[model samples]
Target chain A: MPAPTRVFLSGCSMMILLIGSLAACVQTAPPELLEAVESLDRDLVAIQGAEFAPTEYARFVQDWAALKGRMLAEEDVIRWPWEPNPLAAHLQKVQEEGEQAMAVATQRKEEDRRDAEARLTLLDRRLRIFNSRVDEMESRVVLGQRPIETELLVRQAHSFLDQGLFARSLQATEQASTLIVAQTALLTTELKRYADERLVGTWRQMARRTIAWSRTNQATAILVNKADRRLTIYRNGRPVVSYQVRLGYNGIMEKRYQGDGATPEGQYRVVKKRDRGQTQFYRALLLDYPNAEDRRRFHKARRAGAIPAGAFIGGQIEIHGEDGLPMSQTLGCLMLDNRQMDKLFEKVEVGAPVTIIGALKVSNPVALALADLEQFEEG
Target chain B: MKQPFICYLMVSALALAGGCAQPPTDKLTTAEKAINEARAAGAPTYLAEDFAKLEGMLTTAKREIAEQDAKFAMLRDYDKAEQLLAAVETDAARVNTDATKKKEEAKAVALQAQQAAQEAVKATQELVKKAPVGKDQKPLQAIKADAQGLIASLSEVQTALDAGDYRVAQIKAKAIQEKSLAVQAEIQRAMTKVGAAKAQKDKQVKKHSSR
Candidate 1:
């Protein structure tokens, strides 16, 4: 080849190379940013699962900065060769990239704000839940249902007293008194060891005792004791169904917080029921915890913004089988042992009204004899 | 003819030098070095994890943003998408700090509870030994009951410390401390009984001696 022709060809080849590199940079920039954005998406999912860890956030910021740098650098390279001065184009490209990055960064900043706010909300929820638990414990100690440990202490003191240890007995009594005082102060000022006049009045007005009468082929009265925490499904006044249950740990007075673990206290109807799929936790009676009063309170509180949005109450309350856990573990729902839960599941219908009385004479011999008779008849 | 070969060799050398280029990092600015240091300190990993999430949300946000940007960009209005993106990014940065603060607070609560539990265990250990013991049983058994409570509380505290799971520790500690206080009172009662028993025995001995 001639010298002139060879040199011309080499120059042309170099020009094509420059043009190709510039085009490649332009094409790759947005896609790289998009890829970086996709990675950010995955991180967000992980964050949702476990709140936030410091290391996780640091990584997020680093990637964002790195991607921004790359975008700027690539833009500079593109613009470098295009200006009157060979390097002028690179400067121009860098400026363009800086502007674009500023825009991206600004948008990123807004996203960061929203995520932070959500995280704060979740943190606040956790804190409230913790405080509620502490408050509940204090209340329980104040109530008559003293912790089993305290009872053990009292029992131990009496045992020593029985052994003619008068001094020891006095000491134990003193200890018990101290504990009672401490517990009372922590719980409430108005605690009573015995059912006082106030309690009697409350119980009378509420009609703590009630009876559900069901009759078999022959007619008889089926008596229920609200105090005993048991129900006897009677046919023709003959008891057919008998089961033990743990009523509200706090004796089902008022519906508590969303997860206050309190049993709903109200006159609610059987709104819905699920039979077969009821897990060990519940056999499936969705009680209407939120009667008119509850709805009114909820609406009033919500309108005032006292509770956050999406705070649902009285939605999934139930009187069902103990979910795998012991009966004592239920938040506020009526709980029965597995064997009794299974049996109750079979007998109860969807629409059967479950009357939750505050107290009743469950030890009614008539009811017991009737249940025993039914068992004998079945056998 | 000799000069032609020399010139060709020089040109080839220059071309090769141009092709063998190093990355721009060699000429890194002070800001770039600082950024790199932060990245090396595991900052990048943290940021990546966080931004990856943002990027993900930004995809939908970006799409909506892009649509807005496109719609507005058509009318030469980049304001809406730009404003939205800016707002979202700031919100996103806050998420990390908020999460960290929660964990730290939980840890703090747990720490308080654990310290309280340790005190209770120590206090109970003393009371257990001081309490009266029956002749038939081992003295340690009496101590063991107290020890059992101590052990349970300690184990809870230890678990909390190890896993940094302070919430459970705090709860366990509070209950343990309450029980410990009650136990201390019981021990005091037992000591009084011991004193009375000795008094009664002494009275009988004096009566017999007088006879």
Candidate 2:
């Protein structure tokens, strides 16, 4: 062969040799990559083991390094010039592969994160509920009332609330209220029979009868703020003592019959205070709520089976002192703070005559005065 | 005439070499390689990326199932997720099922590339613990630290699975899932510990025990 032909032949042979060597070099990749991949798989599977041992992380890193090495080898093959752009088309392909892996990993990480977040949210909500329960307990103590066994129920409700369980909370609250009411009603009936029979029936009739007597005898006016749960004694525009009290769960105008949950919206008197310990929840404060008018209605409802047979309504109701419990949770009677009730107990005698107002519609003094001034100016 | 003929012969040889010579085969796709890498890395999103389409369908099915409270509907969703999982497993089964066929060897090896993809899907189903906060920003060091810990655990699992130790893989997977809760607990404990150091200005929120 001529010198020029020899050079040309050498160049072609070299190219072929380089290509073969590069192919051979790349051939090591699959097994190496497989090893790296297997290492990763081992680490992942280990995570699912009992007691996720954090020590496994170290092994993962070592395996990851091996994977990176294999990736580099493939890259080297692609970059080799004699290998005819071994890494060219393959680089894009491998990179895409990397991208795919990354995508899958990212998705799994996100799902894990969201699950964690949900758990955190649930925990926070439960904590809030716990705090609320503690608050309720404190309030009950402050009011000097008995503690009921609703802690477990409340805790269950809290659990539900933590899981965004609003309906469950409502149901639990309703249930708690129902049990309390049933118990209170039973005690009230027992106590009322122990007191005056003539005073039994509906609050409206009781209010009318009591107010008629108080009006005739001339009694002191009572101011009740159902919203703030306060009852104030007033004589000739002078504020006497004001006591915080708990009213019906529904603190509005008193309903005449059952399920009204309202404090009576009319005037009534404290006819008597029974010195008997009545219900399991509290002591008795028998007030003359449904007097003669109450009896008339009670008989009517009794005929109708609306008030249940021989249900006495008035004897167990009165303006009384705290029942030595935490909260002022009561069923229709006026519950006063211990100190306030003690003071009242001394100052007033039985039959001193008290009037009950349904609502306290006091105008904001600042706003009312301003309006009055404006009116005066206009006038 | 002889030089011309030799030139023609060289050209024909070059043509024959170019046409007959296989450039490359048994080369994996980028997606395939990525699936494998993600499988090893234990990166859930990477595992799930290729399954985005299927996952999207699954999510819709899940939402529909969630909307109805009927037991039948809930079972349907469970079945759907199971069906999809079975399909993925079937695709992966190809790698091991036809091991004896010589003609199917290359194809089997090629299908083996899908094991990584299947792994990605499995990893995608894993429950999440923590996520990065802020828009288009990387997670904080604490968050990343937790993730790194989880990643490490998952990687070990991958290794075990590759070694064909199915039991070890299962154990590892379970461990990672359990420890994942620690990250959030850590964050909360840390916050509380720090909060305790601050001025007790927060109104002694009345803690009520009675409901």
Candidate 3:
């Protein structure tokens, strides 16, 4: 009975030992390892959801897969009770790396958002400047006669800004700016040409002749430069006094025909002098315009079809006093203030030589002066 | 007799361990559903950090359950996993609510910004209309075109709002406001300059005519 009992007991002991050993070797991952893997998985999902930098996300995925593979391989190794799981360390490393990757991705997303915001702000500012400059040009009436290319460029720039293409918007705005500056230059050139090409030479000859006539007669001679809106009184061949004058609405150009609002250019004599009550103006020194040279030019212009038929060479041109009205308001006359007209009338005779010319010089000042004169004339 | 005694002890231990240890299936499913609900509520866009934390917790809970499944039958214990999953469900619900509240707030702000931008565009357009047509016309027309572009960008703001990216929509609208304000300021300056120039010319004309 003792021998059989001992054999049964030995077999039961061995079976219990085997069962306990199998339980101990189950190789269940620790809670921490599972937690780390789950954390890593969450990070990967976030990375994907965020649409992080492709290179960084790809690297993170590869490293995560490698660590996961290593953890699964570690499961195949036999584990004994009281021994630490080998995969636990690897999983912890993967989790740590995943966390780092996720952090970087989050940071990158924040940075990208900030960068996009900054770009939008810059683009907006640039578009504002572009818009303002265009407005300025339009306000100045600089754009009415030109092509619409600048506006198109501005629109292109604005579209670029709207699309978040900051560089393209900037480029378009710059192009518009360039076009505007070019147009300004072209306008300035045209203004200078009007004064230089047609007015300067005639003025020099008229001024010299008037000075000579004054010196020879010891009398006052009047010389007017319509481009400068200046009237000079020469006494005994030297300048005596000068006064600012105004002319017709189209005063910058030479008067060519009747009803043209331009002050005429030529040598002439004062046909009559009248006091304030006798003339519409405060005082008047009427000139014999359409004198020999003017009549000749008018006849030639008519013959060449430069002037319309039935348009006569105008007469009754005068140096008049406006009292207080602007001299520019006259039809086609040289005008001065009443005080200046009174002073001249006191020193001049009815037949005194009077010369009216286009300009005094060929410089930009003459052009600018004429343009300013034209403004006053229009007003 | 001893072998039977040991077998009885093992069976009793197994029964005791199994008695209180049910799988956390219901809690896990509940937590998963909560997480899905939060995602559908736009938690990721409006509450990124909070949503990520919730996701990590859910993942940890699922991993704990998986760990329990990997264990030997006698050693399996899902009590901790079940508790964590229950906590995750609560956190997910809170996250969803908070995200919805924040999203609504952001939407209000975005709407205000969009209205402000539209107003700016209108103001700039008015300025363009009042702008004089002269040498400055080219630049003014260009500016008007830019203002038109800003108005067009409002559509993009709408797109962002529709997509539930309220923050982005607000930022874009703010940009438009700033630009339109600048355009208005520019128009004011131009008008002032034109006025000053006209005044000076009139003064000169009066002085010359009076003299």
Better of 1 and 2 by TM-score: 2
Instruction: After the best TM-score superposition of candidate 3, give how far the Cα of residue A84 lies from its true spot, in angstroms.
Output: 7.2
TM-score of 2: 0.35
Residue B36, candidate 3: C-alpha displacement in angstroms: 2.2
Candidate 1, residue B79: how far the Cα is off, in Å: 99
Model 1 C-alpha lDDT per residue in residues A1-379, reported as the tens digit of each score: 9999999999999999988877654423445445545454453444331133333433443344434433434454544333343223333443344334444544554455455444334433433443343233323412332333344334445444343333444454455545544544443232221123454354344332222233323332222223455655554544677766554444333443575444554445566666655554646667777778678877888788876677777467666664421212444667566577667666656555455543333333223332332333233
Best by DockQ: 3
- Compare candidates 2 and 3 on lDDT and give the better one: 3
Tens-digit lDDT track of model 3 for A273-366: 9886888787899999878988889999999998889998888888888633221246578777778889998988988999887666775454
Among all windows of 10 consecutive residues in model 2 chain A, the one with the lowest summed lDDT is: A138-147
Greater DockQ among 1 and 3 belongs to 3
Residue B194 in candidate 2 has what lDDT?
35
* Residues B18-64, model 2: lDDT tens digits: 54532111211222443344344332222222222222323333333
> What are the models' TM-scores?
0.31, 0.35, 0.42
Model 3 global lDDT (CA atoms, 0 to 1): 0.68
In model 3, where do residues sit more than 4 Å from their true spots?
A1-379, B1-22, B70-75, B137-139, B208-211
